[model samples]
Target: MIKTIIFDFGNVFINLDINGALQHVRDTFKIDTLSDEMTAFNSLYEQGLISTDEFLEFYTENFPKLSKEELVDVWSFMLKDFPEHRLRFLKQLKSTSKYKLILLSNTNELHITWIKKHIPFYSDFKNCFDAFYLSHEINLVKPNPNIYKFVLNQNTLTANECLFIDDNADNIDTAKSLGIKTWRIDIESEDVTNLFNVKTNLF
Candidate 1:
């Protein structure tokens, strides 16, 4: 039986235009591809290996033409609206207390700041989870087995008892390898509100 429900933050909750953001950056930088160093730095930032100021400094130095504000805007362009129905689904789920709710996301500080500013019900949504693990804050990002081990160990949960829901195939594969059940969400055509209906076998 699944005693816990783990959720991913992006696409699963707030909408994100990841490809659009990448294209925007490519246009802004006049480059077709991101340098390996830039990609590595982004991963480091997500893992909280570097401070936000340091991260920003690297970008500002690399792209001297863009101002700090413009840089921030470019960085946050992927984030879009959080639909109310998802929150309602989460709240209703939480009210049951039938399962432990966990939110695991590979998110950075700047993105979170933007979310808090724009997603008014952020706090309420957070409170619905029994445990909330943000990658930057925890110094651990998903698709990594350590993060999953950490979540399970911290919550004293067995992998089989948890159902991790994420939009990323890599993330879901990692969880499945560890014996955790998962729902690889289809953001383009599915809504989390239909969780029980869609995954009736699990329920």
Candidate 2:
């Protein structure tokens, strides 16, 4: 029996144009792909090992032609619309009080800042979860077994009793390896609002 539900914040909730964002950045920077150093910097930033000021400074120094605001805009372009029906579903689920709800996401500061500014019901969405863990805030990220261990340990939750839902295959694999049930949502044909119907076997 699944007593807890852990959800990914990106494609599972808010829409993300990951490929589109990467293409936009490549075109803006006139680079075919992100360099190793840039990738490392992003990982460090997501792990909260670096401050937001330091992150912005690195980008500003590398691309002197681009302002901090422009860089933020490009970085945050991956975040798309968050449907209200998802919030409604979450609210209804919370109201049931039948299971522990946790939100686990690998997100950075700029992306969250953009979300808070653009999403009118951010607080309502957040309140639906009993625990909310963001990578930068928690200094841990998905696909890392330690992060899952931390959540289980923190909540005294047995992995077998928790269902982890994410859009990332790697993340799902890690959770499954940890003995947690998982749903790798297909964003193209699946909507989170249909969770009960889609995951009927689990329920």
Candidate 3:
């Protein structure tokens, strides 16, 4: 019996063009590939180990030709629209009160700020979850066993009783290794609104 449902924010909720964003960054930087240092900086930023100002400063210093506003726009280009049907489904699920709803997302300040500004129903969507954990705020990231452990421990939730849905294969694999049921959603073809129909056995 699954008592709790954990959801990933990107792709599972808001659409993300991850590859597109990376291509944009590469073009802007005139680089063929992202360096190991750049990847490390991104991880540090996501973990909240660095401030937003510091993050911006690193980019501004490296790409002196780009203005602050341009940097922000490129950084946030990956995020896309949040479909209304998904929000409706989530709201309905919350109303049922049959399962504990939780949202776990690997997100940072600038991205979330863009979400709040673009998605008008951000609060309504947020309130549907019993608990919301953002990586930057929590200083815990996915594909990491410690973060999954933190969620289970903090909520007093047994891994077997929780079903996590994410678009990332590594994240799903990590959750499964911890004895948590998971769905690695196909963002290109599947809709989260079909959760009950798709995972009928779980229900």
Candidate 4:
């Protein structure tokens, strides 16, 4: 039986326009592509290998023309609204008391700060989950077997007893490799509201 339900944060809980952000950064910064150094830096940031300040400093040092505020805007442009209806759905699910709800998100500090500011019902949404895991906070990222193992080991949950939901196909594939049941959701048109149709607690 499924005893835990794992949810992805971006594109799942809050809407993220990855293409929009990339385009915005390119247009705003007049950059055609991310530098190899920047790419490696981002990987480390996502892996929580460096502090937020260090990440921002790396960008600021490389692109000194852009102010920190402008850089923050570019970093956060992909984050959009977290609708209340979704919050209500999660809240109702929380009341079910049938399965443990957990949130696993690959996000950075700048984006999270934006969420805390813009998403009015953020706390309510967070409260619905028994565990809230962020990549930056945990120093581990999705699609990595170690992170999934970390969650399983920490929660004492077997892979067969957990349902991992993520919009990223690679992440879903990784979870499935660990024997975790998964739903590769489409975030733009479909939302977690579809979870209502899922019969939980079934082996």
lDDT of 4 at 116: 89
lDDT of 1 by residue, 8-32 (tens): 9999999999999999999998899
Candidate 4 structure lDDT:
0.86
Q: What TM-score do all the candidates reach, one by one?
A: 0.99, 0.99, 0.99, 0.94
Candidate 4 segments exceeding 4 Å error = 198-203
The models' CA-based lDDT, in order, is 0.95, 0.95, 0.95, 0.86
Q: Which whole-number lDDT from 0 to 100 does residue 30 have in model 3?
A: 97
lDDT of 4 by residue, 59-143 (tens): 8998899988888888888888777788888888889898999999898787788888988888888889888999989999989
lDDT tens readout by residue for model 2, 1-203: 99999999999899999999999999999999999999999999999999999999999999999999999999998999999999999999999999999999999998899999999999999999999999999999889999999999999999999999999999999999999999999999998888889899986
For 1-203, candidate 3 gives per-residue lDDT tens digits of 99999999999999999999999999999999988888888898999999999989988998899999999999999999999999999999999999999999999999999999999999999999999999999998998999999999999999999999999999999999999999889987888999988889876
Which residue pairs of candidate 1 clash?
Answer: none
- By lDDT, the better pick of 1 and 4 is 1
lDDT score of residue 1 within candidate 1: 93
